[model samples]
Target: MLDLNSSDDSSKRNSLKDPISLNVGGEIYTTTLDTLTRCRDSMLGAMFTGQIPTLRDNCGNIFIDRDGKVFRYILNYLRSGFLDLPDCFSELTLLRREADFFQIRPLLEEIRRYETSVPLGLRGGPLGAILIVKVDSKVRVLHFNLRHGPENYELRTCSVRAFTVDLFCTWRAFLALLCERFSYKTTQGLTSPNPCHPRQNRLKLEWVPRPDELPQEQYDKQNYRGLTVSSPEATWSDDIVNMQCSPCEITDMQGFVEELLKISLAEGFKVDLVTPDPTEILTCTSLRLVKS
Candidate 1:
């Protein structure tokens, strides 16, 4: 087990490091992603915790650690290969630390899923084939969208994001989206895209900027009008609003996980849909994986 002493002393826990690597899905995959890093250590000291975040595989299967403290499972074991139990997914705040340590995309994503204020600021930007809502927090690549109301009566697409508000992370760089029909989730995720309109719309990801925090000068206009400009990406529609977001070449995020963990998941992994419960739709990040 990793040499970690849990004392009531908050300072000790704050300065703690792990002696293990965190593995998921019963298989441990530690490639570019690790379980400990400087970034992860800092996130552990936050006062309040964010909402529970979950991830879905390409098979449309949602996977969340019991109690929803998935980050601990990833961060604590990033180094020594020991994932201490009891404080697993139940500890929500620790999860953010783990994601930063391992550089896991999905984990990073879930962290940014809880931020309501456009802290870093976001506006409309090129989201690959469609325009995406961008967030300039920790990882410059954080972004999402929400559209729901009894006004429409179709489906509500609402979500909360949480991420680092101060990390210089990698962006999609040069990526394109490939549009595809989501045969799955027709009955889920913001009311699902109309089957007939398979190509209704999608915002993959392109060169979305994590803009610098706007100063009082920029906000003057909105501020003058008493409008709170939450995010920089929310300013106005430039050429990006005209851009289109397509599907990515990668079919599913599960494929990538399989190769990372080196374990073959069962043919099908599924969960029953819960009604009245707002459907959480995460863009499954399963990409085709290759053995290293």
Candidate 2:
């Protein structure tokens, strides 16, 4: 006589190798029992292997009372041995819950990895940024000597002055725009002067000439060969003024402030406050943006 227990085992193995239909939250999915049982310690594996009882829908498909839409990803992970989600996928927490219910350790681990890899800015949530614009003025003293007839004359003068403006930031997109337009460098782990605040990354905005613009050395050489030798102090002062006042493809500080506001608004940030709000000034000395 044939061994009855051996025959039963052979039948169970054949059944697990066959195609299985699943009804997950009214969504129908057709997959293989082998895929479902791939994770031997998972709930799906236990159910399919007869270790746990399973319910069936009217159409004879296994009924899972979980989210069917997210189950596709779950099944795909089981089939492909990897996790892949769309860039716009926003159901991380929901998917994690389903993974936990299914007892899929690998899928949970993959989700944790994705969470760690994605930037906090990309994730939808409330965030904040502080913008500070510092302005300073410097005075230069100059002395001139002249000879009048037979007498020597000495003149003391303050011929030129300079104004410097710098922008500091903690916003990612704003910092990126500053870097792209002004060649600013981002500094990480920067702490505020106040000891109470936590350490954070920061960036400073200082204008740098684009590739199309004349290089500093070349410009200096051209100035030296010109009809009048331009003072280095005067040239530096002129550049600072032009960068603040003139507008050329958002090269000016005012244009940059406008772009910052536009970008922040588009990214769901609202202006929280402005320093010295005496008038409707676009380029405020300090600004705070909050997103909710």
Candidate 3:
């Protein structure tokens, strides 16, 4: 609740004073009333509206209990309505924290946009250059960035007019390997609407061809499965389809990725697989990949 008299009293005080001084964590900042109240839903706005009492330090400046160093950026945002980081400023995470504390929606959005920027090299595989595969579930979809020697590959559920039979065969062989080595079981049951099994459960496990420019929301929805193998020098040339190994070679997907990372690192390639979940990271020395 705001007292009308308090508002009038504060207005009178401001009329007789210079630019308001804010002592935020022992740091002094000066700004005008209009700028501070521009975002009416913010805490500063509430303070100006008399809903919250303003506290002052001993030096006769309103005191805010927060980081003095990053306060400049917050004040700058309020003044100019722009988020321009200093040239040497690498403290985005810190600034974002402050923005969140201040409940600034635009500033938080800017931080999110900055954080999701992808690396130049790792942008979705060269368009149409490699087959793209996606596995969908009730909650999300997983994309595979599969490779074979210098050639890249993606999983395919059915033949397409543009792609050749060899690509299909390679993908089929990869499935065969997964079945034999990992003991992967496809979903099996008759469709509720008919007598035919209709590949109902198998549909979830099979890799479906992915189109270029996958939906942004889809990528955000699920974790990605990636492999980082040693570069030109290593002998891990065999693709997932032809990688000769006994059942002991890997226990599961995580184990398989771990073994691949271990082999690649021993050969001196710093391959990294980026995934949304840390628990999904493989056991090998491969570094956890992040997009931002």
Candidate 4:
């Protein structure tokens, strides 16, 4: 909606500038805002939309950092244009994500740099060696276990792989936890008569942060973190088995999908929220629909 011939046209360097008031964690910051917010918002939104919340890593403590907090950092940045982040805060993925979404380019770069530069301790379970995924590649996948533990990252060379995807996608942990708990396997690449076939698999993962809720306390002795999975045996009805597998992972594929995946897929394509009509736009790769 811009008039190319307006005063804030290509001729003016600062004409498109606008002052923005931001409430970052509690403090206030007024800065010259850029149009990149729109682009950043859309990009970040697409990357995280429809994610399973519990599956997200809880580095909640990082928001406050070890010594400096978000509000402190924001205030410092606003007053003197300095980013005084603690070692902890700088390593957080979510903060980096937020920074990118807000078009804080320097902050984004700092976060990425901090991840490789900061030295971390030998904590975090799945215990040792965790992948610092830059992008998805064979090195990241085959060497996953070695990459998992938090590291004392003094200074590391980050190849372009850091930008692509990770060694393994986040979904791997979800799959592992699911299979370990459910005693089930995946149906990754089977073709259907309809190549654009849809698959919707939902399972409830029940966990207790403390020990007592678990039936067995042995895992507690090692501080297995009181983690245990309830049986998926009863969660799926006879129908779900049909879709996930020829017999559903728990039931049969067609029948299982028709009941759950198909219904959910159909619901996603429903364009008319007030009415029952919706444009059934199938995801080109898969016959998937997401109404919202």
Candidate 5:
């Protein structure tokens, strides 16, 4: 009698060399049996080598219950022996879970390496900027041009000033950037309540002006004197008016915003969205950035 075991082994070897079709969660994939069995100790290897039982769909394709969209990455990793993902891909945790289920140690390790290589701010989640500009009480000065008769031709001049009082950011990398480049100091630690990422740590930064900087009152006086000297036709009453003004601590909130956008773009971040639209004002209440 012919050796049935020897004949069966020969047939199995021939099947392993042929192309295999797989239906993973209703998604169809075709590859060679050699690729599936490349990692001898993996779940896929055991299934293809007949060590683990597998079921086939009615269409005669091997069926696997898994996420079909994510399986593309798994198949590509097995084929190329390397993991390559897009720069904007954010589903790393899901991919890691799938790799664990398949018992692919190498893939899991590669994902770990990728996570470590990413920037600290991006590793946590999307980067966001929250800035609030506060304007102090304004001082108005009125000049009466008596030369124009009882019409009281009054010239009204008002100076408005604003400063950044509260600056909050969701990413530490951005906070570090501000501290390194713009001389911002950490004022306090804040915990922001986010629906998606609850209890996330937010940072509040402050920039205090140096004592050498001119006070707001002196600056205003110099500006008014310059205006008086420049206009020879303008007449002023003997009433010497002095308006009360607060000391200047912060002056250029807009400048800070400009530098922030510039550096963020240079560091491979794209603007996700801004509140109140950019056309309305240079300073925004909220801004979000994402890594490319």
Candidate 6:
């Protein structure tokens, strides 16, 4: 529990006269007690109760028991109401943990509400072969023509338009792009080849059964399977947008998609699968997402 002493001493609750220096992990930070106690329920507020023993460094600066570098972010949040993280910020999860430790409810809520402005468009990039989707009721379907070629097994190569970079912190990224592109709830979902129409396939994106739900004995003969983007010899790629990701990448991507579905479905909007399973095998004429 937080050690907040609710005594009648108003002077003690007031901000310290001089600038207070905090030595956190060998890094010295300067701030005021007023700023720290703005959120009275926070751990920092409790620490300044005067009842707690203040530990000082060799240089006589008060010491905090946390990472100094990350503490900068927390201090900034205390000074300013908003959390200004850098573009393409990679340490959101770690920062979230720190926010939790500080017991800053507003900061934690800010992280939860944070959305990436980056857009994920299906423009000229390699796509998964199989996709499973759940959709809202709209019979208008967009058609994609997958032609086999020698290089990269390209699917609908001629129609590519780069929209924006892909660095999504959450599934809200996809939701924003989907809402922006399609006004009437018209967006494409999962992709696969239509074996019924070889040489002239009708590439229709539709929902399919989950892996466990599929019949074990007859699953091998089925034409459509879930897409899983993974290979044993896969290497790390810095280019997240163009790079090919395997099933291992699904932890982040899949979690985002699942969250997207939950939010969309709850809001009375249709949801669809824009990608595939991480462990699915790539095949010709597999389903892919595209703008209509």
- The lDDT per prediction is 0.27, 0.55, 0.44, 0.29, 0.54, 0.44
| TM-score between model 5 and native | 0.40
lDDT of 5: 0.54
lDDT accuracy of residue 7 in candidate 4: 28
TM-score on alpha carbons, each prediction: 0.18, 0.40, 0.40, 0.24, 0.40, 0.38
For lDDT, candidate 1 versus 4, the one ahead is 4
The residue-level lDDT of candidate 1 at 148 comes to 50
lDDT (Cα, 0-100) at 95 in candidate 6: 65
Task: Flag the better candidate by lDDT, 1 or 5.
Answer: 5
Candidate 2: stretches off by over 4 Å: 1-17, 124-292
lDDT for 3 in candidate 6 is 32
All models, RMSD in angstroms: 21.6, 20.5, 21.1, 24.7, 24.1, 19.7
lDDT per residue (tens digit) for residues 142-223 in model 2: 4444345678665533233333445555544444333333322112311122111223435543332222333334333322
Q: Of 4 and 6, which scores higher on TM-score?
A: 6
lDDT of 6 at 277: 49
Candidate 6: tens digits of C-alpha lDDT, residues 1-292: 1233343455644544558888887789888878877778778877675544456676767777777777888889999988887654544545666777878877866665563332222211122212233322122222233335655443221211111112221233233323222221112333322222223322122222224333433333433233222222323345212223233212222333443344333222332323344344121112233221
**C-alpha lDDT of candidate 1 relative to the true structure:** 0.27
**Which numbered prediction scores highest in lDDT against the true structure?**
2
| Candidate 6 stretches greater than 4 Å from native | 1-16, 115-292
Instruction: Please give the ranking of all candidate structures by TM-score, highest first, separated by commas.
Output: 2, 5, 3, 6, 4, 1
Query: Positional deviation of 130 in candidate 2, in angstroms?
Result: 21
Candidate 1, run of 10 with poorest lDDT = 223-232
Per-residue CA lDDT of model 1 for 1-292, tens digit only, reads 2233234445643443333222344343232322333233233222101112224344322232332335435544444444344411222234434454444444444334432322211211121111122212122222222225656433222222222111111111101101121111111221111222224332222111112342333323222111001111222254211113232221233222222122111101122221223232222222221111
Candidate 1, position 91, lDDT: 26
